[model samples]
Target: MSPSPDTSTDTSADDVMEALVRSAFQVMGVMTRISAEHDLSLTQLRVLGILRDRRPRVTELATFLGLDKSTMSGLIDRAERRGLLKRGKNPHDKRVVDVYLTPAGHELEQRLTDEFRRDLAPVVDRLPHHQRVEFTRLFEPLLSPPLVIKPRVTPQR
Candidate 1:
Protein backbone atom coordinates (compact mmCIF):
# COMPACT_ATOMS: atom_id res chain seq x y z
CA MET A 1 0.00 0.00 0.00
CA SER A 2 1.15 3.58 -0.80
CA PRO A 3 0.58 6.69 1.26
CA SER A 4 -0.71 9.95 -0.24
CA PRO A 5 1.69 12.87 -0.51
CA ASP A 6 1.70 15.62 2.12
CA THR A 7 0.09 18.84 0.84
CA SER A 8 0.22 20.85 4.04
CA THR A 9 2.82 23.37 5.08
CA ASP A 10 3.00 26.14 7.67
CA THR A 11 3.21 29.09 5.28
CA SER A 12 3.70 32.39 7.00
CA ALA A 13 2.38 35.69 5.69
CA ASP A 14 5.92 36.94 5.13
CA ASP A 15 6.77 33.80 3.19
CA VAL A 16 3.71 34.26 0.98
CA MET A 17 4.58 37.91 0.40
CA GLU A 18 8.14 37.00 -0.53
CA ALA A 19 6.93 34.39 -2.97
CA LEU A 20 4.58 36.87 -4.62
CA VAL A 21 7.28 39.52 -4.91
CA ARG A 22 9.76 37.06 -6.35
CA SER A 23 7.16 35.80 -8.82
CA ALA A 24 6.47 39.39 -9.91
CA PHE A 25 10.17 39.96 -10.51
CA GLN A 26 10.43 36.80 -12.60
CA VAL A 27 7.45 37.81 -14.73
CA MET A 28 8.80 41.35 -15.15
CA GLY A 29 12.17 40.02 -16.22
CA VAL A 30 10.53 37.96 -18.94
CA MET A 31 8.43 40.92 -20.07
CA THR A 32 11.42 43.25 -20.08
CA ARG A 33 13.42 40.90 -22.28
CA ILE A 34 10.53 40.45 -24.70
CA SER A 35 9.91 44.21 -24.81
CA ALA A 36 13.56 44.91 -25.56
CA GLU A 37 13.58 42.40 -28.41
CA HIS A 38 10.84 44.49 -30.04
CA ASP A 39 12.68 47.75 -29.27
CA LEU A 40 10.16 48.87 -26.65
CA SER A 41 10.55 50.03 -23.08
CA LEU A 42 8.56 48.15 -20.46
CA THR A 43 6.19 51.11 -20.13
CA GLN A 44 5.64 51.19 -23.88
CA LEU A 45 4.88 47.47 -23.81
CA ARG A 46 2.39 48.07 -21.02
CA VAL A 47 0.73 50.86 -23.00
CA LEU A 48 0.23 48.49 -25.92
CA GLY A 49 -1.36 45.95 -23.57
CA ILE A 50 -3.67 48.59 -22.08
CA LEU A 51 -4.78 49.88 -25.47
CA ARG A 52 -5.52 46.43 -26.78
CA ASP A 53 -9.20 46.57 -25.88
CA ARG A 54 -10.06 50.05 -24.65
CA ARG A 55 -9.85 53.55 -26.09
CA PRO A 56 -9.18 55.66 -23.04
CA ARG A 57 -8.78 59.41 -22.81
CA VAL A 58 -5.25 60.69 -22.38
CA THR A 59 -5.81 61.73 -18.77
CA GLU A 60 -7.47 58.44 -17.92
CA LEU A 61 -4.69 56.41 -19.45
CA ALA A 62 -2.11 58.53 -17.69
CA THR A 63 -3.83 58.02 -14.34
CA PHE A 64 -4.08 54.30 -14.94
CA LEU A 65 -0.34 54.13 -15.56
CA GLY A 66 0.51 56.46 -12.63
CA LEU A 67 2.22 58.85 -15.02
CA ASP A 68 1.89 62.62 -15.12
CA LYS A 69 -0.19 63.90 -18.04
CA SER A 70 2.79 65.49 -19.73
CA THR A 71 4.90 62.37 -19.34
CA MET A 72 2.10 60.22 -20.70
CA SER A 73 1.69 62.62 -23.61
CA GLY A 74 5.36 62.33 -24.46
CA LEU A 75 5.18 58.56 -24.35
CA ILE A 76 2.14 58.66 -26.59
CA ASP A 77 3.84 61.07 -28.94
CA ARG A 78 6.79 58.72 -29.39
CA ALA A 79 4.51 55.76 -29.93
CA GLU A 80 2.47 57.72 -32.44
CA ARG A 81 5.62 58.53 -34.38
CA ARG A 82 6.35 54.81 -34.48
CA GLY A 83 2.85 54.24 -35.91
CA LEU A 84 1.88 52.04 -32.95
CA LEU A 85 -0.89 54.25 -31.67
CA LYS A 86 -2.89 57.34 -32.48
CA ARG A 87 -4.78 60.10 -30.73
CA GLY A 88 -8.19 61.30 -31.80
CA LYS A 89 -10.93 63.47 -30.44
CA ASN A 90 -13.50 61.45 -28.59
CA PRO A 91 -16.72 61.03 -30.59
CA HIS A 92 -18.90 61.62 -27.56
CA ASP A 93 -16.82 64.49 -26.27
CA LYS A 94 -15.01 66.30 -29.02
CA ARG A 95 -12.90 68.23 -26.53
CA VAL A 96 -11.42 65.04 -25.09
CA VAL A 97 -8.59 63.16 -26.76
CA ASP A 98 -8.62 59.36 -26.75
CA VAL A 99 -5.86 56.88 -27.55
CA TYR A 100 -6.25 53.84 -29.73
CA LEU A 101 -3.94 51.12 -31.00
CA THR A 102 -3.09 51.05 -34.68
CA PRO A 103 -3.26 47.75 -36.55
CA ALA A 104 0.50 47.57 -36.38
CA GLY A 105 0.35 48.13 -32.65
CA HIS A 106 -2.15 45.30 -32.32
CA GLU A 107 0.15 42.99 -34.24
CA LEU A 108 3.09 43.90 -32.07
CA GLU A 109 1.06 43.46 -28.92
CA GLN A 110 -0.02 40.00 -30.07
CA ARG A 111 3.54 39.03 -30.81
CA LEU A 112 4.70 40.24 -27.42
CA THR A 113 1.93 38.31 -25.72
CA ASP A 114 2.82 35.16 -27.61
CA GLU A 115 6.49 35.53 -26.85
CA PHE A 116 5.83 36.21 -23.19
CA ARG A 117 3.64 33.14 -22.91
CA ARG A 118 6.22 31.05 -24.66
CA ASP A 119 9.01 32.27 -22.45
CA LEU A 120 7.02 31.80 -19.26
CA ALA A 121 5.70 28.41 -20.21
CA PRO A 122 8.53 26.50 -18.60
CA VAL A 123 7.98 28.14 -15.24
CA VAL A 124 4.22 27.73 -15.44
CA ASP A 125 4.49 24.16 -16.64
CA ARG A 126 6.28 23.24 -13.42
CA LEU A 127 2.96 23.28 -11.64
CA PRO A 128 0.56 20.39 -11.99
CA HIS A 129 -2.55 20.92 -14.09
CA HIS A 130 -4.82 21.28 -11.06
CA GLN A 131 -2.39 23.62 -9.33
CA ARG A 132 -2.16 25.76 -12.45
CA VAL A 133 -5.94 26.11 -12.61
CA GLU A 134 -6.08 26.95 -8.93
CA PHE A 135 -3.27 29.47 -9.27
CA THR A 136 -5.08 31.27 -12.08
CA ARG A 137 -8.35 31.30 -10.16
CA LEU A 138 -6.59 32.82 -7.14
CA PHE A 139 -4.78 35.43 -9.22
CA GLU A 140 -7.72 36.59 -11.33
CA PRO A 141 -9.34 38.56 -8.54
CA LEU A 142 -6.16 40.54 -8.03
CA LEU A 143 -6.41 41.87 -11.60
CA SER A 144 -9.86 43.38 -11.12
CA PRO A 145 -10.41 47.16 -11.25
CA PRO A 146 -9.63 49.01 -8.07
CA LEU A 147 -12.48 49.73 -5.72
CA VAL A 148 -13.42 53.39 -5.39
CA ILE A 149 -14.60 54.62 -2.03
CA LYS A 150 -16.45 57.91 -2.28
CA PRO A 151 -16.41 60.23 0.69
CA ARG A 152 -19.61 60.84 2.56
CA VAL A 153 -21.11 64.33 2.45
CA THR A 154 -22.39 66.04 5.60
CA PRO A 155 -25.45 68.27 5.17
CA GLN A 156 -25.33 71.69 6.84
CA ARG A 157 -27.91 72.16 9.57
Candidate 2:
Protein backbone atom coordinates (compact mmCIF):
# COMPACT_ATOMS: atom_id res chain seq x y z
CA MET A 1 0.00 0.00 0.00
CA SER A 2 1.16 3.55 -0.75
CA PRO A 3 2.02 5.75 2.20
CA SER A 4 -0.67 8.27 3.04
CA PRO A 5 0.29 11.94 2.80
CA ASP A 6 -0.36 14.06 5.84
CA THR A 7 -1.55 17.61 5.31
CA SER A 8 1.09 19.38 7.36
CA THR A 9 2.09 22.96 6.60
CA ASP A 10 4.79 23.28 9.25
CA THR A 11 8.23 21.71 9.12
CA SER A 12 10.27 21.09 12.24
CA ALA A 13 13.80 22.41 12.75
CA ASP A 14 15.12 18.85 12.84
CA ASP A 15 13.52 18.16 9.48
CA VAL A 16 15.05 21.27 7.96
CA MET A 17 18.49 20.45 9.37
CA GLU A 18 18.33 16.91 8.10
CA ALA A 19 17.26 18.01 4.64
CA LEU A 20 20.00 20.64 4.39
CA VAL A 21 22.72 18.28 5.57
CA ARG A 22 21.67 15.57 3.14
CA SER A 23 21.56 18.05 0.28
CA ALA A 24 25.00 19.35 1.14
CA PHE A 25 26.39 15.84 1.13
CA GLN A 26 24.83 15.17 -2.24
CA VAL A 27 26.42 18.31 -3.69
CA MET A 28 29.77 17.52 -2.12
CA GLY A 29 29.78 14.09 -3.69
CA VAL A 30 29.39 15.63 -7.11
CA MET A 31 32.17 18.12 -6.39
CA THR A 32 34.49 15.37 -5.14
CA ARG A 33 34.15 13.45 -8.36
CA ILE A 34 34.75 16.56 -10.45
CA SER A 35 37.80 17.54 -8.43
CA ALA A 36 39.24 14.07 -8.81
CA GLU A 37 38.85 14.30 -12.58
CA HIS A 38 41.12 17.34 -12.49
CA ASP A 39 43.63 15.53 -10.23
CA LEU A 40 42.99 17.93 -7.38
CA SER A 41 42.12 17.45 -3.75
CA LEU A 42 38.73 18.67 -2.57
CA THR A 43 40.49 21.28 -0.47
CA GLN A 44 42.44 22.48 -3.50
CA LEU A 45 39.24 22.73 -5.49
CA ARG A 46 37.80 24.76 -2.61
CA VAL A 47 40.75 27.13 -2.78
CA LEU A 48 40.08 27.71 -6.44
CA GLY A 49 36.45 28.44 -5.71
CA ILE A 50 37.40 30.83 -2.90
CA LEU A 51 39.91 32.67 -5.05
CA ARG A 52 37.52 32.95 -7.98
CA ASP A 53 36.13 36.25 -6.75
CA ARG A 54 38.23 37.72 -3.97
CA ARG A 55 41.89 37.96 -3.13
CA PRO A 56 42.48 37.39 0.57
CA ARG A 57 45.60 37.38 2.69
CA VAL A 58 47.36 34.07 3.33
CA THR A 59 46.50 34.10 7.04
CA GLU A 60 42.90 34.88 6.27
CA LEU A 61 42.72 32.05 3.76
CA ALA A 62 44.14 29.65 6.30
CA THR A 63 41.64 30.74 8.92
CA PHE A 64 38.73 30.47 6.52
CA LEU A 65 39.83 26.99 5.50
CA GLY A 66 40.38 25.95 9.13
CA LEU A 67 44.02 25.10 8.49
CA ASP A 68 46.99 26.18 10.56
CA LYS A 69 49.57 28.50 9.04
CA SER A 70 52.08 25.77 8.17
CA THR A 71 49.54 23.46 6.62
CA MET A 72 47.92 26.24 4.68
CA SER A 73 51.35 27.30 3.46
CA GLY A 74 52.01 23.78 2.24
CA LEU A 75 48.75 23.65 0.31
CA ILE A 76 49.43 26.99 -1.27
CA ASP A 77 52.98 25.94 -2.05
CA ARG A 78 51.73 22.89 -3.95
CA ALA A 79 49.17 24.89 -5.88
CA GLU A 80 51.79 27.49 -6.74
CA ARG A 81 54.16 24.85 -8.05
CA ARG A 82 51.38 23.58 -10.25
CA GLY A 83 50.87 27.16 -11.54
CA LEU A 84 47.27 27.19 -10.36
CA LEU A 85 47.72 30.18 -8.10
CA LYS A 86 50.21 32.81 -7.07
CA ARG A 87 51.03 34.89 -4.03
CA GLY A 88 51.81 38.58 -4.19
CA LYS A 89 52.37 41.36 -1.74
CA ASN A 90 49.24 43.17 -0.68
CA PRO A 91 49.21 46.64 -2.26
CA HIS A 92 48.32 48.40 0.97
CA ASP A 93 50.68 46.36 3.13
CA LYS A 94 53.97 45.20 1.68
CA ARG A 95 54.39 42.74 4.55
CA VAL A 96 51.06 41.02 3.88
CA VAL A 97 50.73 38.47 1.08
CA ASP A 98 47.58 37.81 -0.89
CA VAL A 99 46.71 34.71 -2.88
CA TYR A 100 44.87 34.79 -6.18
CA LEU A 101 44.19 32.37 -9.00
CA THR A 102 46.25 32.35 -12.19
CA PRO A 103 44.63 32.49 -15.61
CA ALA A 104 44.90 28.70 -15.89
CA GLY A 105 43.31 28.38 -12.49
CA HIS A 106 40.45 30.66 -13.48
CA GLU A 107 39.85 28.67 -16.66
CA LEU A 108 39.81 25.41 -14.75
CA GLU A 109 37.53 26.88 -12.13
CA GLN A 110 35.10 28.02 -14.80
CA ARG A 111 35.11 24.58 -16.41
CA LEU A 112 34.55 22.91 -13.07
CA THR A 113 31.70 25.27 -12.30
CA ASP A 114 30.12 24.50 -15.62
CA GLU A 115 30.42 20.79 -14.99
CA PHE A 116 28.91 21.21 -11.55
CA ARG A 117 25.89 22.99 -12.95
CA ARG A 118 25.52 20.38 -15.66
CA ASP A 119 25.74 17.53 -13.19
CA LEU A 120 23.27 19.14 -10.82
CA ALA A 121 20.81 20.02 -13.57
CA PRO A 122 18.90 16.78 -13.24
CA VAL A 123 18.23 17.29 -9.53
CA VAL A 124 17.39 20.95 -9.97
CA ASP A 125 15.18 20.22 -12.96
CA ARG A 126 13.14 17.90 -10.78
CA LEU A 127 11.67 20.95 -9.16
CA PRO A 128 9.12 23.03 -11.03
CA HIS A 129 10.28 26.47 -12.17
CA HIS A 130 8.40 28.42 -9.52
CA GLN A 131 9.61 26.11 -6.76
CA ARG A 132 13.18 26.43 -8.06
CA VAL A 133 12.92 30.21 -7.88
CA GLU A 134 11.48 30.00 -4.40
CA PHE A 135 14.17 27.55 -3.34
CA THR A 136 16.95 29.93 -4.45
CA ARG A 137 15.26 32.85 -2.71
CA LEU A 138 15.00 30.92 0.56
CA PHE A 139 18.54 29.51 0.40
CA GLU A 140 20.44 32.67 -0.60
CA PRO A 141 20.31 34.20 2.90
CA LEU A 142 22.00 31.18 4.51
CA LEU A 143 25.10 31.57 2.31
CA SER A 144 25.93 35.23 2.74
CA PRO A 145 28.61 36.11 5.38
CA PRO A 146 29.09 32.38 5.91
CA LEU A 147 27.92 30.54 9.02
CA VAL A 148 29.95 30.19 12.18
CA ILE A 149 29.18 28.36 15.38
CA LYS A 150 31.17 29.27 18.47
CA PRO A 151 31.62 27.04 21.45
CA ARG A 152 29.73 28.00 24.57
CA VAL A 153 31.66 28.29 27.81
CA THR A 154 30.07 27.54 31.15
CA PRO A 155 31.26 29.17 34.34
CA GLN A 156 33.05 26.85 36.74
CA ARG A 157 31.35 26.33 40.10
For 16-68, candidate 1 gives per-residue lDDT tens digits of: 76888999899999988888899999889989999999999998888888777
lDDT of candidate 1 at residue 15, scale 0 to 100:
78
lDDT of each: 0.89, 0.91
Measured with C-alpha atoms, the lDDT of residue 40 in candidate 2 is 96
Runs off by more than 4 Å, candidate 1 = 1-11, 146-157
Best by TM-score: 2
lDDT of 2 by residue, 1-157 (tens): 9977553644676688789999999999999999999999998999999999999999888878877789889999999999999999999999999999999999999999999999999999999999999999999998887763334579999
- Model 2 clash pairs are none
Candidate of highest lDDT:
2
Q: What is the lDDT for 111 in model 1?
A: 92
Off by over 4 Å in 2: 1-11, 148-157
